[model samples]
Target: MSILPVSSIYLIIDLISGFFELLEYTFYRRAMITGFLASIVFGIVGTYVVIKRIVFISDGIAHASFGGIGLAFFLSHYLVFSFDPLAGAAVFALISAVGIGLMSKKKVQREDTAIGIIWVLGMALGALFFTLTPGYQTSMENVLFGNIYMISDVDIYLLSILVVFVLVAVFLFYHELQAVSFDEEFAEVAGVKTTFFYLFLLVIVALSIVFLLRFVGIILVIALFTMPASIASGLSHDIKKIMLYSWILSLIFVMGGLFLSYVFDFPSGPTITLFGGIIFIAYTLARWVRV
Candidate 1:
């Protein structure tokens, strides 16, 4: 007695048919391209995030971007200025990143406390803005849960530019970033301008979060950002190796999750995150057994 729904069986058949005739489906192609670009950015920046142990702050920035998205929607009708939610998320993410970075100083405030405040405040503001927007029906499901099928040619172009810029910038500054991630005091002692580099890293994180919003949404972006790198970190201590592994793992998770979503009609973002979590759990179990 199988409990599989008839739709599920039909989906499996459709998936097989679609595999060979991939070009027939524009949505699938767009998702693949977007996922690939997202994996690359996450691989590069997430390694640094894991090494620096600022995953919490990264999560904060991701959530805080919601405030920007809500604000964009609220202002678009009334304001003379053009309002792009993605741009709004970018601006809000950067502000949150900079705020977290500056407030992280021991003399100023507890970093975790600041992150908690930003995280909660961001959601609260978003709720308030949504409430105030007149006659605008809520469609925040896409922002909150993500729908990679919604990605457009413009998004692809923007992602392409962002990926190139991140790769080149990080490549040029690899050594400095490496020093700062492993040991900030030592980097400062070596005249690495730790504050400047730290700020630069946070800004990159902000950009990455904004770029990933459509692909994974704000709710699951943190998982995509951290899980692949986390798995990589478990396998290697070297930053380069970790990044490479993260990219490969992320590709697997995203591609497999997309296929599963297409077949079973599940949300792509959570499916992807779920796959990553499963892998992480297996790795952890393996390590524990080894010990």
Candidate 2:
């Protein structure tokens, strides 16, 4: 009443109500719901990824999944076999994850070299297969950049199942995985199955990449995975606490994405990714300055 003008207060209230009204749309609601769900995975897995310094591993798996998509399409169209691209993507992702883990564990090649080779090979295979497929491949556009509004009920169902799976799996092996993530050599010396947990962790990463493909595209998904945990790590040293903080931070980052997109007439994926990048960068700079 004193400092704020009456007109300004009404305008603010109008904007708030209008924004909530936008959520009434089915697509916007789904976008927000899936975004929130993805944040949970992002927080837990992202914490482990940052702790273990395996940020780019998910990138490779995500890219590699393209090959599976093409293969699934080819099989479905040419052989008339029923196949889901997402399932194919999950399969390819698991293969890539396991391959990377084994190669690094066995000292067969530099980890980055292995990842790069797999990444390109997957994309190349995807392109080749798509070219061979008969019709104009319109669906692939959604796969490349993501279209949250175009996400289906089936996608949400699958995402929900994967979230539950990830939670239960993490809960059962939290301590063992935590130890492996924080210090593999020490954990191995301490009688933990470092190799098993390491591979298991990568498997989780692979699954996450596949499920999150719709909400965030392949190119931008890594930032969401890497940044939330990195930010939480700076705030807290305790792993569990870091995950909790990261989850909350991820929730916040996703909150305004849809509204910004609606307002600015932009793609939902880039809006979300850019929003996250700004927050991540701000936190980094602030932390650096404080130091």
Best by lDDT: 1
What pairs collide in candidate 2?
Answer: none
The lDDT of each candidate is: 0.86, 0.86
lDDT of 1: 0.86
TM-score of 1: 0.92
Every model's TM-score: 0.92, 0.92
lDDT of 1 by residue, 130-245 (tens): 77877644347788878877788888898999899889988999999999888899989988989989989999999988888889899888887788998899888888899999
Question: Which ten contiguous residues of candidate 1 have the minimum total lDDT?
Answer: 133-142
Per-residue lDDT of candidate 2, residues 87-131 (tens digit): 888899999999999999998999999999999999999888888
TM-score, structure 2 vs. true = 0.92
Per-model C-alpha RMSD = 3.1, 2.8
Model 2, stretches more than 4 Å misplaced? 1-15, 134-137
